[model samples]
Structures are given as structure tokens and as C-alpha cells.
Target: MKSDMTKGNIAPILIKFMIPLFIGNLFQQFYNMVDTLIVSRFVGADAMAAVGATGTIMFLILGFANGLATGFTVLTSQSYGARDENRLRHSVANAIILAVIVTVITTFISVVSMKGILRIMNTPDNIFDYSYAYIITIAYGICASVFYNLGASILRAIGNSKVPLYFLMLSAGLNIVLDLVCIVGLDLKTFGAALATVVSQGISAILCFVYIYKKQHSIWPEKRDWHLEARDTSHQLRVGIPMALQFAITASGTMIMQAAINLYGSVAVASFSAASKLQSLITQGMPSIGQTMAAYAGQNFGAGKYDRLKGGVKNALIIMTVYSVVAAILSTSLLEPAMYLFFGSAENVAIQLPWAIPYIRFCAICYIPLSAIFIFRNMMQGCGFGFLPMMGGVVELVSRAIMAALSMKFMIYELASACDPAAWLTTGIFTFVAWLYVAPKIERMFSGRQKVID
Candidate 1:
């Protein structure tokens, strides 16, 4: 476990580690995809659309929680790499503690804000109750989501990637079964979808925490460590806040796009939402690499293995580029079936197909650049280039604003119909805007890194 950070063939090592991470991520996301599948197949299109309707808002709230856990993962990876057992335990303990805090706050806000947030997304009046009920149910389990994330991250840091993956597979399987029973067999509808999601997540989280408590030597804490040290809390907050807010900013921006899509009605909403669920599978690809990079970079950086960090990034870029191209080819070929899978067989895939296809195809192209942004940022954060990562986060937040301000009017003038040209615009041009914003900042950081070495 310890050797993964500093030794072994870097490329194969990363790929081997990330395969499970990717599979786990796929399964993790598969939990919801299964629901979308079952819902589209049996519960009817409007119900499926109702569930999809809340995705952006979910990202807004869930993304913030994820960003904070990301910070904790960085700290843990670094501590583990340094082989500083004391620091490792401290970070792990605090990560769990921090997860509890963020979870409670987010769950509260999500529940309270569910209806307004849905309304602001301009969800049609008919879908409003379903969105509210689904979101609130999903929010009830935010703590579980964080529990799984934080614990799984710790496992990854210490090179136990497979355990988390196993847990995710088990829980996701449970989710599929429950989803089938709720939405397919019993006819529970949107609220059933939400229940399935939360229960699945809760199962995974509880088992992971219990196993860590009982088994993992890496996470054991002394009584004194229970209360977080001042420096630890301060650093976690400093780093976590920007990371969390980056997601918040991006998620909030997405919420705006969701509002616009809603104005087009349930079909447009269904198309966008269905494509999004399908697209989630693709985005998880390189991000699996980015995550592995996070642990690899952080652990190496903390141990001062600077050369390994350099090698890891080079390998990451090569792999991500190849993947982007391959995914583009596959998505282009599978476009019809993929959309058909989410929208169901009976429905005319044509209605949603064109909409899902272009947006996903655009993603396949932008994915590399987006991944380039992630690799550098994850490395920078892992290395505790604290303020620089935050600066990059600022770039992402600002670019979304820039993209929206400039693009909406043009989109209104252009496609301007139920066809959803905005999907391409939202995920594509907006992403390019962010890439432009981040590129120069990342270049400056590396330039400074070179200076420090010289």
C-alpha cells in the first residue's frame, strides 16, 4: 500500500489503481443511472423527467460537499506519502469530523431550499412536488454520501482502492434491486427513485465506516486526536472552503441553465436531464485519472518526491488525451442507443436523441481540455499550492458567469426552439471559457515552480 506512491512503473500503476476507481465511480454513478433506466422504462417519461429535473440543483448542493471531502483527501494522501503516521491519523480523524459538519449543514439547506431551488430552475408546475419530494429525500442522506466519499478517499490514499469499489458495487447493486422494486414492481414513481438513491448510499456508507472502525490500521485515533487541533482545522477550512465553493459556483451556474431548460417544458427538461445522466458516465472517465492523480500527487508532494509528481502528471496527460479521443468515437457511434437507453425503447428516441447526441459529442471534444484543467489543478492542490488552486477555482467560477452572460442571448437568437442548442452551448462553449481562464493561471504556477527549483 505504502509503495504505490513512490515505487513501481508509474503508468501501469496508475491505470491499475484507477481501473477500480473508475469502476467504483461508474458503479457509484450507476446507482442513479439504474433508476433513470427503470424509471424511463416503466414509471413513464414525465416521472423520469421529474427525477432528472433536480440534477443541477443536486450538483450545486452535493458538489459543495464533494469539494470539501476532496480537500480532506488531498491532506490524507500527502500525509500518507510522507509516511507520517501521526499526521495521517490526524488527517483521517479530522476528515471524518469535517464530513459530519459539512453534511449536516448541506442537508439542512437542501431540505429548506428544495422548493425554491426547484422553482428557480423553472421546473414546470406539475413536476414541482415530485422534485421537492425527491430532492428532500435525497438530501436526507447527504451525510451518508459524505461518509462514503471521505472514507473511500482515505482508503484510496493508503492504497486500498478495491475495498471502496467493492462496497460501491454492493450498494449500487442494492440500489438497482430497490429501484426495480420501488419504481418497476410497486409503482412508487419519483419519490421512489429518491428513496432508492438514499438507501443505496446509506448502505455503502455505514458498511465502510464500520469496516474502517474495525479493521483499517491507518485510521485509528488516539483519544486526544478526537478534538481536532487548531492548525488542522484552520488548514482544512482554508483549503476546503475554496474547493467546496468552486463546486458551488459551478453548480449554481448550472442551476441557471436548468432554469432556462425548464422554460422549454418537460420534454426539453427530460432530454437535458436524460443526456446528463448518460453523460455522467463519460465524465467519470478521466476524472478517475484526476482522482488517482490527487492521491498520487499529494502523497508524493508531502514526501517530497517531486520527480514522481512530474512523472505522474505526464502519464496522466497522455492517458487522458487518448481517452478523450476514444470516448468521442464511442459516443458518436453509440449515440442513438445511449439516448434510447435513458429515454426507454417505446419512446421516439428522435425527440431526445438529437439533443443528447450533440451535447455528449461536444463533451467528448471538450473533455480533454477539461481534464487538462483537472490534472493540473488536482496536482497543485495535492502539493498544497494552496492559494493557486483557489485561484484556479476563481477562474472556473468567473468563466461560468462569462459564458452565460455572452452565450444565452446568442443561443436565444440562434437555435431558439425546443431542440436544445443550449445543451451544446452550456457544456461546450462554457467549458472552453473555463479552460481559457485556467490555462494561464496554471502556466504561471508551473513557471513559479520552476523558479523555486532553480
Candidate 2:
């Protein structure tokens, strides 16, 4: 169902909207987490590391697409809030066109660079072939991932987060079934896991596309809405490129961190990979909150309800803070069992637990700062304060790069683990400061409008 967040009780509406998003993100992460689970448990730790090895590169490519899709949806949300169906319709169509263009380019580049990227990251020889097989297979289906991300993002922008959750649940189930069939039954190994992910995502993308094509409502476009408006395209790129750069910048930092992690050899890689997956599962709440804040901020900003937007930010911060605490507790509890699940309970594999535990704990501790960064940065983006978020991205990049360099130079792999919290803390500070600077200006702008109307 469609929602008008512009006038509702801020906290309830935001919570209701975010719950499905939170669930959907869990299922979405499961698409890969399942792959890792099945591959590690059924195949081996090396296989798990192979899948894990692809994470940063995939993040670099798919993260950019997701960010672009998210940036495009800000326009849709604002338009929906303003009840400007024309703008919403045009933005949707143009955004789809842009997604198609970007998907093609990204897929091509990723496929071509897969092996080279793995080599540059210094993928260990034992896992190199497995990593190549997994990533190349994933690269082949990049369009599916990008399409689903764009389609789902557009839906949420219009206050229909539930539909995407339904789609993801379906896709995730299918992925698990395929994982069993391919990895267990057929014993297809790493390639099978990657193929399962692509095919499942493709199904979700197709389903989402069909739904939007047929809906023809407020945010969905009809035949008449299919034309490309140069103005809309320009606006999309203007907003989207910065967001995309922000994601790419952040991913590049992770890429650096991954390279640093790779220097430690396969055991370290496998442990880090497994631990990273668990942390990702725990930290889903941060992104869910950010996404909810984005929609809330966009809608209220477009409706010129600056105070409502502020209220949404405050409520979202509370939500994220509570979630961060819960996540830290859960992560600390599960980190051990999760490692056993991934690397096996075998005696030889037990040695990796010592290395993995500290990294996972560090990540869990960092969730608090991460929550602040995600909420503030995404809120800024949704309110169309694009530059601040972009600057926050820059902060993230610099902090991680610096930390990773120091860690690698000193051979303190644990210090490499500290990079995440450091980046989150620095970027959170920047975004918080930016919000402080900008909130008053927005209030003044709207205050003048209210006075004129009076």
C-alpha cells in the first residue's frame, strides 16, 4: 500500500516502513550469506574464502549501482510527497533507462577485470581458481543484481517497502534450494554457489519489473511516461553520480582493506571472510535505518515539512542506537558458533578461531558509530544535501586508506580490523557537523515561505 509520510505520526510511520526494509535486507544478505554457509559447510573453508574474496569487488560494482538507484529514488519520494505525479513518473522511467545503461557497462568491466582484480588483491594461490570461478560467474549476471536493486529501491521510494521484502523472501528461498541442489546434490562447488545467487536475483528482478510495468500508479509509469526527459536525466545524474561516487569511494577503501587482509594468506582470508559475513548479518539494521530515513527525509522535504524531517531524523537515531546495542550483543554471542559453522569443528580449523574472534568483536563494537554514519549520511542525501554526504564518503575513504596503510606497514592485522570503526567515527562526525550547519538554513528557507503564505 502507498503511504503519505508527509502528514503521518513520524515515529510509527517510519517504524512501519522500516520493518519490511529491515526484513528485506536480511533476506537480501542471505542471498550471499547462504552461499557462504553452503559453500563453507559443504565444500571447505577455502571454498568459503573464495566466495568471500569476491565481496569487495562485488561491493565496488554493485554498490555503485545500488547507490545510483537510491539517489534516483530520492526524486521519486520527493515527487510523491509533493503529489507531483508527472515528475515521479518521468524520474522513474529515466532512472530505469540509466540503470540499464550502467548495468551493461558495469557487467562488462567486471567480467573483464575479475581475474586481474583478484590478482591485484593478491588472492592466495590455493583459492585463486575458486575465486575466479565464483566471481566470473557472478559477473555474468551483474545485470540481474543491478536491476533488482534499482527496481526495489524505486518501490521503497514510493512507500511500498513490503513488496520488495516479498520478492527477496522468494529469491532467498530459491537461492537456498539451488545452493543445496548445486553445491550439495550436484557438487558443483564455488561456481554453483555463484550461479545460484545470480539466478535467484534474476528471478526477483524480473518479478519486480513485471509488477512495476503492470501497476501504472503514482510512482509507476505507463506507456506515455516512457519518454526520456533530458532535464530529468540531468537531475538524476547530478544527484546520483555523487551518491555513486560515495559508494565507490567507500568500497575502494574496503578493497584496500581486502588487499591488506589478503597479505596474511588463505587462513586469514577465510577467517576474515567468514567473520565479515556474520558482521554483515548483524549490521543490517544500520542500512535499514538509513534507507528508512532516506525515504522519510525525502518525502517531508518535498512537502516542505522541515520539522517533520527533523523529527524523523531524531526517531531514526533512537531506532538505530537501540539496534546497534542489540546487534553488538548478538554478534558477541554468535561469533564463536558462526566460525565453527563456517570453518568446521575439525581440530586443524580450530586455530583460525583465535584470529577471527577479535575481528568480529571489533566489527560489533563499531556498529554504534556505523549506525550514526549511515543515518546521518543517508538523511543528508535524502534531504538533497548531497555535498555533505559526498564529503562524508571522502572522510570514509581517507580514514580507511590511512589505517590500512599503517596496519599493513606494521604487520598488525588487528589494526586492519580497526579501520571500520575509525572510518565510521570520522564520517559520522563529519555528517553530524554537516547536519548541524544545514538544518538551520533549511528552516529559514521554509520559514520565509510560511511568512509569505501568511
RMSD of each: 4.1, 1.6
Q: Give the TM-score of candidate 2.
A: 0.96
lDDT of 1 by residue, 110-173 (tens): 8887777776667898778777777888888787777778778888887777888899999989
| Global local distance difference test of model 1 | 0.72
lDDT per residue (tens digit) for residues 106-176 in model 2? 88888888788898887889999999988898888888888898888888877888898999999999999
Cα lDDT listed for each candidate: 0.72, 0.85
| Deviation from native of the Cα of residue 200 in model 1, angstroms | 1.3
Q: Which residue pairs overlap in candidate 1's backbone?
A: none
User: What is the lDDT for 237 in model 1?
Assistant: 76
lDDT of 1 at 196: 86
Candidate 2 pairs with clashing backbones = none
Q: Alpha-carbon error at 231 in model 1, in Å? A: 1.3
**Residue range with the least summed lDDT across 10 consecutive positions in model 1:** 413-422
TM-score of each: 0.88, 0.96
